[model samples]
Target: MTSTSARPRLAAGQTTDKDIASFLAHTEPVDALAQDGYLAGHDGRAIAQQLRRPGLVRALTFSVCHSARPDTDRFYQDDEEEAAQWRRRRTQTIRDHCAVCPVRAACAELALRDEDVHGVRGGLPEEKLALRLATDADRLGKARAADDRVERLRSVRLDAEREVHRVALMHTGGSVPAAKRAENNDEVRTAVQERDAAKKAHRTENGWTVAA
Candidate 1:
């Protein structure tokens, strides 16, 4: 039931200038978004120009995905048939919107560079984007490096969170009974001291030499 003319004319794993221009022409007018502060200091054309950059564009004021359903529905659900139905609908919606988007190339580029991105972008889903990366050697290498950096940052965040939780538990003396909260003895005192020491050490690591 779809029109052949509406399909994107992209080559395998490629987005040409012509393709970008064609889709960009279909993007929503930015005058209202700009007035509402979504565009901020940048004009629509300026934002469109940045779509060619390798980096993700922070200003997605004109992104078609904004009007679509949330990305979560694309995932498998308790009902297999229902989930498939949703996925098909979501994919079709993405294709329709992306085919006409002026920033489709940029949207796809962002999806390629960042592994954490989800849902439909650049008229394709994450799985399709992954396929594109897998088939391109240079792009695959770049994506691997980006994935490594993302994993490293995530590991650092998890470690910091765990340390914070440990310190909190130490300060609270490991969740003692309510009646025992007021009955602080040697064990509680030792825990408090350990918590304070840990806090001081953390501060020192961050260049806060002066003890509070």
Candidate 2:
């Protein structure tokens, strides 16, 4: 995101022909932006004004914001359950906002191009965007085949880990602390060990040489 201070701030409801022209010059492709109802309720003039204002443009076009929310926390979460809850809430919030946004298509394209983007953008969380890019790249015969393979393995690993957790909870009467202690319990321990083994095997199959 670029600084808005480079251009003079516009007064409330104030827009000049020059500002509109500048916005037009920097505008993304209209046809692409218009697809998928991105511009459903917006007209040319309103969109031009939004584009001219850098601050407003970023706010409306991007998912991350200064406002406090479950999504505002950095992605390096220490708690898996909390992280999953936050991601679900954040994803829904972003999707709802993108539903009527005028620049959603542009946002989505940028997100696909930058797979490392943090936070949600264009209604997709970082992982989802990576999957989308990998899928698209595969369709286009791009060099993202490895990424696609890794992502698939990652998904399997996640599912296996969840299943382990489920088994652990079931063995521990649904108490997380009890579940942790259940590592000595054959059922819970077996589930965890199996998940770990499967994850290691999948990574090895993908040519990952590092120790798990």
User: Who wins the lDDT comparison?
Assistant: 2
Which ranges of candidate 1 are over 4 A from the true structure? 1-55, 66-84, 140-212
Residue 81's lDDT within candidate 2 is 60
How much lDDT does candidate 2 score?
A: 0.50
lDDT of 2 at 170: 62
Tens digits of lDDT, candidate 1, 85-175: 7777776766566665544655665556554336666666768777865665485465456445544554555565565565555436557
Point out the worst 10-residue segment of candidate 1 by lDDT. Answer: 203-212
Off by over 4 Å in 2: 1-81, 138-212
- Please give the TM-score that candidate 2 achieves against the real structure: 0.31
Per-residue lDDT, model 1, residue 114, is 58
lDDT of 2 at 126: 73
Cα lDDT computed for each candidate against the true fold: 0.48, 0.50
